[model samples]
Target chain A: MAGSHSLLDLTAHALAEEIEAGEVSAREAAEVANTRIGEVEDEINAFVTTTPGLALERAEAVDARNGGRNLWEGVPLVVKDVLSTRGVRTTCGSRILENFEPLYDASALRNFGDDLIVVGKANCDEFAMGSSTENSAYGPTRNPWDLGRVPGGSSGGSAAAVAAGEGWWALGTDTGGSVRQPAALCGIVGLKPTYGRVSRHGLIAFASSLDVVGPMTRDVRDGALLLQAIAGHDPRDSTSANVEVPDYLTNLEDGVEGLRIGVVPELMGEGIEPGVREVAERVASGLEGAGAEVGEASLPHSGYGLPAYYIIAPAEVSSNLARFDGVRYGLRVSADGVHEMYRKTREEGFGAEAKRRIMLGAYALSSGYYDAYYAQAQKVRTRIIEDFQAAFARYDVLLSPTAPTVAFEIGEKVDDPLAMYANDICAVPANLAGIPAISVPGGLSEGLPVGVQLMSDHFTEPTLLRAARATEQVADFRYQMKP
Target chain B: MISEEQVRHVANLARLGLTDDEIEKIGGQLDAILDSIEKIRELDLADVPPTANPLDLSNVLRPDGPRPELSQEEALFQAPERVEDLFAVPRID
Candidate 1:
């Protein structure tokens, strides 16, 4: 059994406060997280790699400097395997880059240099391709709530680690609910920032257009603190927005008083479990009771979000993953010719899900089929964005269940590709529309966590987080209530 | 429905080598995924201008100047088969 440490109960922000005030040293904070990883990692299998020595070294540096300007300074952070960490291995849960170590830190990690200690690399779906970590070459991470259930992925490892108290918080990437769905399943707060809000220079790309680096934390406040630390423009990422990042902490406590909250009926309809809908409805009424106007808002084109994402994301993945040719770093297979070498190495290196997406993408972008598949999907994406624009004109924020259901058992949806893809629908529309969305713990259904998702217009993270805090406040659950 | 031959071609385009049995299984999966994605074809979206990138920004060019560059050793640090200063691969005829 993992002996409970005193720092285990503190949120990332709280731990930072302690370190900032000299109440506790940064090394102590890092050690507590490293120790917790030892106790629970054998069971949950959340991380692909753990870096206690690096974490302790960074923590000592923080202690020497008395922490930094960021609120998450000196706090232990578990980076999802998709994000590049210099020196430490960053295997995007794929065998292709199994032995790859980045030469330079990703821009986001550099943004937090010396502020956050590196705890470990959280496991994820190979190339951030699947909804469950089972697609990872390493292995799947189990839900802390139930040993048999999935910690929703491809950011499942990050979500599970934070929820299970293995780390103060972790970084996750959301191309299509990879962050929010797992955070929903794991019952921690997850935020998918408006596209380009956070720099993606360090984030391994699953889909260039839809990918947004996000934070998975124990509470919405912690998420806001972490977002404030990492949210900024970078010239390195061409798609990064050149916009001012508002202080996410300022209006976070400004309750949803007189706010216009819209309950998305489309999201509430079929496929969403009655248990998940009940919590979302209760959250709506709770907002209504608190003087926020709750009404039905329709996102008519959201139904197309799933298929469009499947098409569009894979199209991007095909292009992005092409860089992993056999001649480069990581795994390679010897063959007679260069082309054969490429084919054989990829065949050996990439897992099934990765190949599936790659093939799908290649077919979509292939000659004679581009207009039918890739172009058509892009048009659908535009319509989805228009639908959001129309809805947001009336409602301050849209409310829905983050996922259709709670954490599903492992191996339940593995064989079924569409079933795994369907898990992304509720969260996919936000990514398509390039809006900021967050998943806050609503309540438990069948003793498992359910998430209430709130979304706002692009760059409305402050408003989105304000509504999130209101939802968290009304919910009859407590943060940091781990299994 | 996608044919097995088409799947092979697509796999070839993706540079992924798959066995015949694996091709049969994966082809079915692709067919099912395509069936679902066919819903996009149902919509009358011919008039909607395609959004290749979400943001409307174009040509975000960085100032042309020499900044820090990784040395040869650092750049080739993780090569699968490193041979001296260059990355080695099978000789191509």
Candidate 2:
């Protein structure tokens, strides 16, 4: 038990290397992760379900067969409940599908091969809506940093689990700021890859166009290693990019010497907390100190990002969520008529936030309102994309504070949807333009962690990771959580 | 501002049976949200084409051939109610 406890201090990359060298067996790594989960699950509420038997079965298989031939061999990891894991109850923190289990694995999970052990499913916001995991039908996931405060969502469970060392790393789906904002609050590394960089075949959709699979980890290097294992094209998901996947670790150590970095003045404006702004400034200065050219840049349409995202994402949500009626799988309510069955089932199954988004989406897509709301939002989305294109012409990467404030109390923003939506102001633009963005733990403020967001052009995760690595070394904020 | 009637209509269109209290509450919330998002109208984007997708790929048709498919039992595994090989639901008439 003492030996297993020490393994928690190592990064996923170091743990993999140890397992490969036979100093640690696959079963030992799984046991350590299970121990960590047992220690922290109640305080953190990071997982909806834990799969120790499945993890141990897979670990024993790896030990008997290849024995750490692959990069991720014996690495215990958690998957956000939004991803389908065959035979494991995958709930997107919604009562609608509380008992739902998929028959197949997500394409991204399929890419992990035989070596990566699936430790558990992380909790998230119901149907991946809302900025805090308070929307979860299961109780909210508490921030490991402060029990009273929330771990940001809809990927809160994944971030908290990683922060508390429940697993070496975990996967989260980011639509808007779900992944980055949560990672920022928990003081870990989260990357939202370019829209099609990873396949979304078995991910239950929140917003189809904006959703992307990303990795959350303790450090930037582990994030890169996990991305290497999961990213690439899949015929199963037509939206998956067919471009060449680069070896992310190859150029990860390459310092940010001559790279051009842009600091958006707009992001540091009114709503940003002073502490968060100070961290962004420190990251900018750190980059400049590393010999990179830094200057102020502007993306004018970014101010519209939150408003546009709220419309477009809900518009898609209304369409994607229509599949959960009583006719198919998931929860069903019995009524005399079929139509009444759908209505009653949905009324009973969905939570308040899920109903709100669905209704908002329906109103936006209704006949007379389509051109004014949905189509207009799409036009604004185009302008936001073009604005990024213009900025990328002058700079290689842009930096901003991941969220306006640190993690708030669990019930703080739950009642005000607009206030909750504001959390994604700095995050939604990357999703809008289909670019790669990552959140690295910036220095803490008032004893709470702040995240510095780094974004780059499409398919440029290598450069983004490189810049993040350099900034990470300079800031060097130690991440810790008391259970 | 969106009236409770409009919210009720939207709930009907979306096939959700929201209570009167929920309708009154959601109506006020939607009004505030829409009022803020209404700022999108100020932009003069007459000529810009809407981008439904960032990637411009078209015609993503898969090969038409025999392939592995989920078995009937596996497909019906998660059904809330099932009879034989079919998902059971309420009577239409």
Candidate 3:
């Protein structure tokens, strides 16, 4: 139980000391972390695959090569199921990929090998489709703070694991609000780096343009450290940006003074729970108290984000997920002919949400509707980008409630698709516009955590983290939920 | 209007097998989702090119040589049925 804090909470510098002095072997760290997972994972349903044996073996190897290390040596971590880890099952919480063992590692997972131990694959919404973890075929990951409450999805499992102290940190993919929203719900920190900052190679495509791999940890420091580790360009991902990985841990000591922080007026307005608004306001006051210039910024275009995202995301989901047909790869169901095989495979493989998105996407991309639906949605995307650009030009960072409400009961929004979709109101704009955003615990709403988002323009993670760190100092809930 | 026939057509395109019940069920859900998408039809988008990525980067460099692919064994490891290193399927002939 000694190392049982959010993987991000372990103070990597201290862990590195023990590992360096032979006080702790990487194998020992891996065992400790795996034991922690064993203790609490069942209550949280946070893992799709816990590769304990491989994790221990890899940890031993890291200790053996102790001299060659990065900041995160001997740190235990989890990769979300959506990322392909070579020779390990990467189910993406879909029956289609249920038994599929990836032949290659995602670019981030491959780079994560040095010094760090990959504990296992975290659970997720089927193909990263929904806003709540309830959609996962594997079963919803319960929010560690309150087991009956939902953990935000599709990165819920990763967020829940980190919140439950199962690992030092975990990698999560945010297509809409997958990473940040769950982190908020679970009272942890998650960062959605500037679009293209992290390579998407081997991350099972889910709305490719919106999908970004990021780190979820106990606090901003670990979030930033993990971001620094996993972020960079990969040739395999055509959209990956060629950007320098900033030393995020070194940069966090800088306080957010005289920095311009904008509070979007619409976010704090009606529909945002009163408790959530209070926390968001406290975060703002906390930032202002830290000598940062806080101002009210209006983004009228935000009201349209849900509709625009639904169209654009599903349109991409329709095309990107087209690869899962029962053909050369994935689940194959066969009958008399090839067509029936495709039908049977998809029918059994895809869950309801996946089917809905595929159909919606196909409809938008179809000939009769292409001009009116997909074409118009692209233009709206352009407009949303312009709106964010304008906001960033006037403000250093944009702040909003990560979700309008806290974790609802499981199966609450599952039947109501629109209510499930609306939960990403605060987080989706960044993905649509391709910006960097971080969610830090604001406060609690009826004992459930709330996240205040700090968003900045492309490649401005340094500024985003500075603002988030400043907010973190004032909010002071770094260890709000202890396992 | 998209009917059960269109759903069947799309299921084939996506290579997913659907039962009569599933097709009937999904047909309704798809109808609702498409109805929401139909809202986009109201927007006046003139001379707008379809945007794939919000960031305008193109022609990202790839390693200019062939990368080794997975061996036949690794490739077929997850298939429910396989024979002679090829995925075995129900005979079409």
Q: Judged by lDDT, which candidate is best?
A: 2
Residue A472, model 1: lDDT of: 91
Order the candidates by DockQ, highest first.
2, 1, 3
lDDT of 2 by residue, A1-483 (tens): 345459888899999888888888889989988988888898999999999989999899887775336777679889999999888899899988988988788999876664448899999999889788999998999999999999999999999999998988999999998999999999999999999999999999999999999999999999999998889999999999999999999999889899999999889897999999999999899889998999988999999998899999999999999998977688898899988999999999999999989988999999899989999999999999999999999999999999999999989989999899999999999998899999999899989999999999999999999999987987849656445
Distance from true position, residue B73, model 1, in Å? 1.7
Better of 1 and 2 by lDDT: 2
Model 2 lDDT vs. the true structure?
0.90
| lDDT accuracy of residue A371 in candidate 3 | 69
Which DockQ values do the candidates obtain, in the order shown?
Answer: 0.80, 0.80, 0.53
Q: Please tell me which model should have the higher lDDT, number 1 or number 3.
A: 1
Candidate 2: residue A381 lDDT (0-100): 93
What value does the lDDT take at residue A10 in candidate 3? Answer: 58
Q: Note the Cα lDDT for every prediction shown.
A: 0.90, 0.90, 0.82
lDDT of 1 by residue, B1-93 (tens): 889999999988888899898899999999999998998999998899988877777989999999988888888877877788988887675
Taking all chains together, the TM-score of candidate 3 against the true structure is: 0.94
In model 1, the number of clashes is 0
On DockQ, the stronger of 1 and 3 is: 1
State which docking tier applies to candidate 1. Answer: medium
